[model samples]
Each structure stands twice: as structure tokens, then as C-alpha cells.
Target: MVLKRVRANFKRFIKSNAKGQTTTEYILILFVVVMVALKFRGLMKEKITSQMDTLGTKIEQITNDSE
Candidate 1:
């Protein structure tokens, strides 16, 4: 039946790729992290480069009556 073919395929896959499973998982995770970093690099740069009125500065200004 179809179930037998599926099971056979599953077994074959498990046997063939099991050895490199950890390395594969790590590479996949690293790829995802690199992709996300690349995607957000511009946004992070903007946040860091911003010189005005962040939350901490605002709080300090209010406390010191400089606002």
C-alpha cells in the first residue's frame, strides 16, 4: 500500500542523513540568524546612530527640569 512506500522512504531518509543531522541543524540556525541580522542591520544602525531624545535622556531631562 501507499503506507509501505512512505515508511520505506522515511527509513531510507533517516538512515542516509542521520549522521549529519546536528551539523545540518546548526548550519540552518546560523543561516537564519545571519539572514535576520542582515535584514535588520539598517534598522539597528539607525537606532544606534540616533542622537535625540531617547527614553533615558527624556527621563533625565524631566528629572532635571531641562525639558
Candidate 2:
């Protein structure tokens, strides 16, 4: 009957669209991860630079003391 045919088509449409929805969700998650990584990168760079500077100062002091 016509009702059965309509139901069948609706089911097919939903099945096809599910993949697209899942792909969109994955893309959104990936975007969020990339954004967070970029934000942290700057903070990490600053901390590394500060640590290296501190280490260099200590080494210099030690050298001066030795001489």
C-alpha cells in the first residue's frame, strides 16, 4: 500500500542522513581539539623559553665562580 511505501522511503532517508550527521560530529570534535592545541602551544613556548633562560643564567654564574 501507499502507507507502507511512504514508510519505507522515510526509513531510507534517515539511514542515508545518519552518516552525514556522524561525519559532522567528528569534524566538530576535530576542530575543537585543533583549537585547544594551538592555544596551548603559545603557553608552552613561553614556559620553555623562561626555563632555558634560567638555566643559562645558572651556568654563567657557575662559570664565573670557577674563574
Candidate 3:
């Protein structure tokens, strides 16, 4: 599922004489990370909202106790 089209302009990155991963590999890795984040955005948002709601409830409880 790699975007081969994006690799054409990345030939220079592949010309590395070293054995480690090249710039092209880094780009592909970042693309995968972005894709994963996009896929899980809804779940992440839900978790964050739930956490915030709990925190707000706790704060309200503390305020009531202090009063």
C-alpha cells in the first residue's frame, strides 16, 4: 500500500551509501503514523472527553466539600 508515486521524487533519499534507513523511509513511517492517528481519532477523542468529564466531576465534588 506504499505510495510509489511519492517515491519518484524521493530517489535522492535512497541514494544513501550508508546501511541505515533513508529519508524516504522516514517519510513513509510518518505517513503510517498519520494514517493510524486518523483512524483512531474518534476513539481518542472519546477517551479524552470522558477523562475531562471525570475531572470536572471531581472538581465539583471538591468545591462542594470545601463550601
Taken over the whole model, the C-alpha lDDT of each candidate is 0.82, 0.90, 0.81
Candidate 1 vs 2: which has more TM-score: 1
Model 1 ranges off by over 4 Å = 1-14, 17-19, 51-67
The TM-score that candidate 2 achieves is: 0.48
Predicted structure with the largest lDDT when compared to the true one: 2
Question: Global lDDT for candidate 2?
Answer: 0.90
> For every model in order, what is the number of clashing pairs?
0, 0, 0
Residue 54, model 2: lDDT of 100
What lDDT score is found at residue 7 in candidate 1? 83
TM-score of each: 0.50, 0.48, 0.72
Model 2 residue-pair collision total: 0
Q: Please write out the lDDT profile of model 3 over residues 9-67, one tens digit for every residue.
A: 45644565343356557878999999999999999999999999999999999999999
lDDT of 2 by residue, 1-67 (tens): 9999998886777678988668767999999999998989989899999999999999999999999
